[model samples]
Target chain A: MSDKSITRRDFLVKTAQGASLAVTGGLLWAYLVRQEAKAQPYALRPPGALAEMDFNAACIKCGQCVNACPPDILKLAPAGANLPIGTPYFEPRTGACIMCPDIPCLIACPTGALAPELKDINKARMGLAVIDIENCLSWKGLRCEVCHRDCPLKGKAITLETDPRGLSKHAVFRPMVNSDYCTGCGICEKACPTEVAAIRILPPALVQGKIGDHYRLGWTFDTEITQDFKPSEQAPPAPETSGGKPAGMDYLNDGGGL
Target chain B: MNTPADLSHSKLVSRPLGARLWSWRYVVLRRLSQFGILLLFFGTAHWAWEWPAKTPLLTGNLSASELFGRIPMADPFAVLQIFLSGHVLQQKVILGAAIVLGFYLLVGGRVFCAWACPVNMVTDLAGWLRARLPIPAMFVVSRNIRYFVLAASLVLSALTGLAAFEWVSPVGMMHREIIFGLGAGAMALTAIFLFDLLILKNGWCGHLCPLGGFWSLVGRTALVRVRFDKTTCTHCGECARVCPEPQVLNLKRLEETGFVTSGECSNCGRCSPLCPEGSLAFDLRPLIRKHGAEGSISSVRRTK
Candidate 1:
């Protein structure tokens, strides 16, 4: 073979090699991105953050939000943290978001990863706080209501539901989270007195469930209660009399056979 | 013509200490540029360094940043990838990307790789060590492979609905991890270092970096370029020896164009300082035009 020219077999082998290498590398790189993008579903983002998928796509991973945070609670997730690399997140257990009135982090965000439309910090939903009933001091018939007391929205976000203990003079007040008012700022989680934090913050998508439109409670005033099922106009005929003894035997009037 | 013996590396080393340090002026400036950028970001984030207006001096990593609470800057290639992923970026980030794009269009695009990229420091160290270690290359790959990788990154970003290269880029990993805090991102840097040091020479930047490939394409219309004087050149091969992207130093092409014409030339200022014949120097495109016209007139007079 000439030094410059290659045989057809050589050309085929080279092409095959290049194609296989490209396919292998492309698959591995794609897998890495997929894993990184969905690494931590439970990670709590800064206030006004977009939905998880949108946040992942939109965040440039600059950490400006981390700098703007007044309480220094926000951190850009480094690699191996199991969150998307360089994306800003906060751990409520250590340093919860203070729910700054100004919402500096949201304002500092160059991208709309933290939605700019969020003017009121009170409405920002970073995550949902879910109480572990088994471990909660309030649920165990105690007077501890630290979570409710420390909630930024106070009575509106978390209301106490009074329940009388069985035959006991004292009552237990359970802290109930109102989803409509709860901002998920995580101040309540930080205030919980439990050793391991009974009230923990979680991404709403991970914990919140939707009630589909298929079912409706008729008792509720909002439910229209459409009469989709109607009864037949003519009722069934009355049962036929078995005998002429006034349709049935009168046990009380019958004489004793004995 | 002067011989190669007149401009040996030994002669440079034998100069006075001040003169010898002067020879490394570009290298020192490059290191300062790289670390100084990192320091500004780190100090603002960690130490709360603020401007007179009480905003951060510089916030964010190299991927994106806000300077003095007002000016926005972003990586154009990264933004492009994100755009290709079907995300409608906010006006701030889009404007930031445009500003950066326009700046790189004025200067050479690969200026970021040589001056600002933290990964460049790691790769440069690996290259320095590789030259001294006598390690044999384990493989050979064409430099054009980076262009292919660049193409694939765009295609994959569209296909996957994520910025494909940003997710796994060692450049992002090194800078972000350093400024924020250390993490497993260092592992990627280590892999690139070893690959460049032992497996291949200048493997990451020269052969496989899609970001570098993107910048190389942008560099085609750059105003600043390395001017080459063919008459003074002795073909001693000194400039090519020190060059990271040595293929850009093709003597025949330089002789024809009177300047480094290839977009792949990074304008790193490495070859210019070390040129034995003093043939290579940084020149503006407009100045080169005037010089070309004057040289043509002089040559016409000589013919007469």
Candidate 2:
């Protein structure tokens, strides 16, 4: 028993066992975590899937949490990203998390990987997406607030752009995003509907966050737009994997300009 | 740890210690088991989740859209892919033959314990877990039940198929609810496993699953089997008690009288190490060199 007590060799054995256990856990995690098959966010689940967020590494490949996401804000990396198979990606167009006290996606994820026991979305660790000045339409002297109107935080994440000259007979058409209030919900990007979307959401790494606390959404200068505007229907579909059209996405064709 | 088995028949003479000292590579066999099981766990779970995502083109003989029509092989036996479906008494006859073949011809009833039955795997796992528990020691059942259970299962499966004895065949339930409709009536199955594992040790394989009945019969005439040197027998009786299957061998007169063997023995060698005398040895030869014995060597528990 004394020989079994804390010794360097014992420590090494424990570490090796722990390492193997962790790898096994990462593998076995598939069951314990409950990661499920996930199609694109817009497609319907076969009726029994819950969505959740990836809190551990924010990069699982399963995509369930992405689908169950209330906003349809999540997307997967093209095919191979370092993230876990069921990791969640965000899309802003469908709807924002709305900071719904319910946090449906978190509940849906079989793995706690996405779930934060925290009581609120405001508290959950989905990375915050901020507006980049170079990409914001308003920064380029164009009309935009798609980010402002769609954000559940509303006035907090965004503010109205008033008509400086009082040019018309109605409420100012100017739309602006509050650099301070934005949660990087990305609803704005999905909501923008721009050709090369003037406002877009990027990974949370875009801004450094405080440990144990959400990094507040911040906007900065980051963009290079070179495409002319076009309606979504007219926009060519995004290219897809070599396999058949993915489970929930349309295959992009090489057909000339739509 | 490497098995200390002596494969050579010429090992009657003592060997020099220097020649016998060879270090062995302790490849954790269980790690492979873990890897395989983990792969299955992840693969099945994740794959099953996707099954509902895409409408399957073909689910067995039933077409995708034909969710409400006749299926080609919805019978429980087909679903389980186990015994051929038909009648119970015939099944008994088949199981009885299978047991005989295992003992006399094919080595052991491994197929019954390995591939065909799910209860065996579950019990194997339970036995592993039982090692660390504070509960009472394990009690091995007589091996005769394997053939008995197998015979009973087949006959019952046939009976159920013909709409006679429905409650007895677990195979039918496995196929009908688990394979055909799937996720159907799993509650009944889960309850059975819970009862068998928690309340009784390996109860399903040892007592409930009739498929085990078939294997036990087969193992009896197995060419290689556990033999005891009664001279070393302190008569601790652990061999008799811990034997996973009953009627394995007679502990008292193993060397002299030779225990009755048949197709049903699994050759698990539970009694080998438990013998403090190390008198028990799994040998390649017959336990009793006696053809002088005139009992129709029972292949299974035949009413005794």
Candidate 3:
């Protein structure tokens, strides 16, 4: 066999080969992967996570969060799984974030993907729990308050409001989600008893509505005061005096038309 | 066909575990560590499953471990991800990475490939089975492909904004499969094994694994290395046959430099134990003095 040595020439040749491979691989990823990619609704992130984009960029894909989860709801996305791989996520219906007091997942994070400043777990907005009123047992008039009962924030985040349309004798108590206090922990979503849960966690991106900039209620505007308070000049002229005034009115006299 | 004295002398040298214990000492140590590390991760998993609430064992996975009540150790690649991602790098993480990096620099970086990576052990089993079976390597890939893979993975990470390889890495996958029982991780590990066993010999570790490639780069100036003695060598060629990265072994180069200077060399000590003439051995060197004419010569003699 020839005694092959890695000369400088060979090193350059290998480097060229490696560079070519890298270029081709990168191009392939750009063309094939980016072209066909679909946006996955953001998974339920651990408490203290940055915004979706920041979290995706910051997370190192270590399973520290999964290990720290006492209830074991957190799982690192597996390779080729529906979600992007290695980031921590949990399916609400399968299991929900238990909202640990210390927020152990945040503490366990080596990167600030889950920010340490998120000392209050209640501040976490992982996703919004939107109730499908049509499918809700309570909406169908069977008395179910599972979501309101199971909510981590209890009465603040979720409250049972009597269905206004229900008969007085048989009031349907519908569970309403108050976005202000809801942390989106998904406990209510997970605890829903329906085959298809009436309350489901929707990623913040999906459920949070964008306010239209153009909308301003007339009462809220200061323009009301600036405008003339008097009746407009264009107001219709007073109807001509009726041709048939009563005879008694004609006699009454003088000075004016009533 | 040999006489009783010849048989005894041959048996003494090739005792496998008795007289030549030191020859295989590192290999034994590596195996013990590999198995022990695996057990440490899996034992907690098993205990966690049985108890579900109060596990007696420590909490961690293979990617990052906090063993013995807060002695943190992290994967360097994982740390690299944190550094590149613009995240707030925690003090504990940097300390852990430094500790691990220091260990590999002092020993050899590729020691992780040979001793700690669970995927390496699985591939070894597959390679062993293939050697015994009527299997032929489908193709040969340049060992340098891993460097390209490493580069491309980093590029992809930059584009995608995450540590992309960690998601699919068979090393982390196999570990997860064992501890977390992820079905997808199991599938990924199986696919890697099949690709390594059937597609190319040592394909994953030698040609495709970015982590191993990164470590090889880190190990370029490693203190611990395989020393080759030219005077005692009979040119038997057994070492090359057993070597996982045979490209690192150039007989003429060994004759010239008296040591394996290839960064790709794992310093696994396979060649040392298999060298019929005991011409190769492990040696420690200071970084600054490496490759001096007198230095190499003295190290070779010391090994003898």
Candidate 4:
């Protein structure tokens, strides 16, 4: 712990090296984890799901999506250890939603979180959920194939993009879908739990057609769907010394605790 | 690095150990974690260093679970994978937590709050910087904010099918902002750093950071912890002095059993390292068969 053991300069360099090593080690662990990892995608979409939410800001992560569906097609989770929280998905354990008419799940949402229309009921309106370059399991150098076969937006939203550079030894892992033909079926959305969904639904009501959030801000942040968190109406006042307490009471002040 | 024999031989020497039945924790777990973190570093470095050379926008490993339906409702990493995929507030949260928890576990909690998380580091820097700048008045928010956040995230997910806060959540916002709002947020971040460091020492842990709140609570049930020797009791308040947060002493009290202030401790071990008496050593275990088995702990406050 002494600076004399290693010069300050040496310590900084070692820290940098340690930082790199630590990160590399973690990623290696993930890959090693992938080697033994067993979970796989459900082969089909639940029949009862309404339109899915977008990848980014679409769903508010309220857990209502999971509650609404009786078939247990929905599950909510956030990112990380025991982080069983945000971002709802479909499990389809006992029963799939089966593209039920009237989309019971969508109707339950108090917040239009899910699209009002079911995927096959008519034309779906969700925008496509895109994969990120940083964490797309495929991008992480692993070969993942859950987005394709499981997509309700099968032909359109959950398709693939190929490597034009011809560097990859295995180029056959292609899965892309057409956005125009795709309905914002949450099959892809509900299915995604990895850091990001390979495919997602954009709910038409929140997209261009009827999606409206001040239309002006829409011009700037089109990528964003709903604009919530507008300062809680009863915003509490910042906490401070109460009752105009004598300046001596504030522990942060000179005379208070010192 | 060799164990500091000299440091171990202070006035308050730890009585030599006999065949204690169990410690449950191991230094190698940390080593393995370190090794793991190292691999992740290289992977990301490889990704960043070789990005232009080879990029795969779609189609990852078929072997690994893709989006959800692939594995019913099991694989925990499945949801996490989706979160970190960088589409939303995709930060290296898993990696950050692992490295910090892993590396620091070998020593203490410094890594959890320092080495791994960019946000914690940044806030720590801000907490440090405030000493040099026109410090803003610091404020303390509800400690349960992270749970509130976790709850909100779940509620939001159910409502939207998306992680709504992944953008607003500090970690999420930091990740997205860095990649997308890089240019727009430079000055803002700098100001935040200064404010956080100078005005709110460890504000991310004490006031902000939902994740820290999350881990601190769970980690309290940790297999091992720092144990303080009372035979050489000086009550110097040294542990209290070096401590970065309130409630840690009471939290560490053996009587409290397995971190009474579980969520409060960051495991930084600052107090242990700084003690002149060398009275503190890490101890671990769940609550014993009987309460107050250790008698009144040195860490107990007058009120608690």
Best by TM-score: 1
Q: Count clashing pairs, candidate 3.
A: 0
The digit string of per-residue lDDT tens for model 1 on B1-304 reads 2455454444444666666556678899999999999999999999988895688999998888999888999998889988998888889998999898889887888988999999999999999999899798897889999998998898888877888888888898888888888889889899999999989899999899999999999988899998887766667787898899999999998888888877788888888766644667788877876765555323211110
Question: Which residue segments of model 4 deviate by more than 4 Å?
Answer: A1-54, A57-258, B1-115, B131-162, B175-188, B251-261, B286-304
Candidate 2 residue lDDT tens string, B1-304: 2222221112212434432221001112323443443343233323432233442211221000111112111222222212322312223223333333433344555333433344344455665566456556356554344444444445433433312112223443343222222332345455555645566665666665554554455455566655555443455455565554545455544556454354445555555544434455445545344322422232211111
Prediction 3 global C-alpha lDDT: 0.73
Can you list each candidate's DockQ?
Answer: 0.67, 0.01, 0.35, 0.03
The sequence of per-residue lDDT tens digits that candidate 1 reaches over residues A40-154 is 8888999898888778878888888988999999988887889988889998988999988889999888878899999998898988889898999998888899999889888
> What does candidate 3's lDDT look like per residue over B1-304, in tens digits?
3854344335435555553666567678778888888777777645553233443244456567665546667787776764665556667667777888888887788988898888887788777777777878677667887887787767776676556566456787677666665757777677778887788888888888999998998888788888776766656566787788887889899887667877788887777765655667777765323544444344333222
> Model 1, residue A157: displacement in angstroms?
1.8
Which of candidates 1 and 4 reaches a greater TM-score?
1
**Stronger candidate by lDDT (2 vs 4):** 4
* TM-scores of all candidate predictions against the true structure: 0.90, 0.32, 0.79, 0.38
Off by over 4 Å in 1: A1-16, A166-169, A226-258, B1-16, B292-304
lDDT of 4 by residue, A188-248 (tens): 5555557545444443343345545555553444436335325568867655666665443
What lDDT tens digits, residue by residue, belong to model 2 across residues A1-258? 666667878889978986675456334423322222222223212111223221322212233344344444544332122222222344454544455567655553332334335565544434344556676666555566666777777777567666655444334344565545555555666677567666654444545555653443233233222234334677665655555434233323443224
Native-referenced DockQ of model 3:
0.35
TM-score of chain B of 1: 0.92
lDDT of 1: 0.84
Question: Measured with DockQ on alpha carbons, how good is candidate 4?
Answer: 0.03
Pairs clashing in candidate 1? none
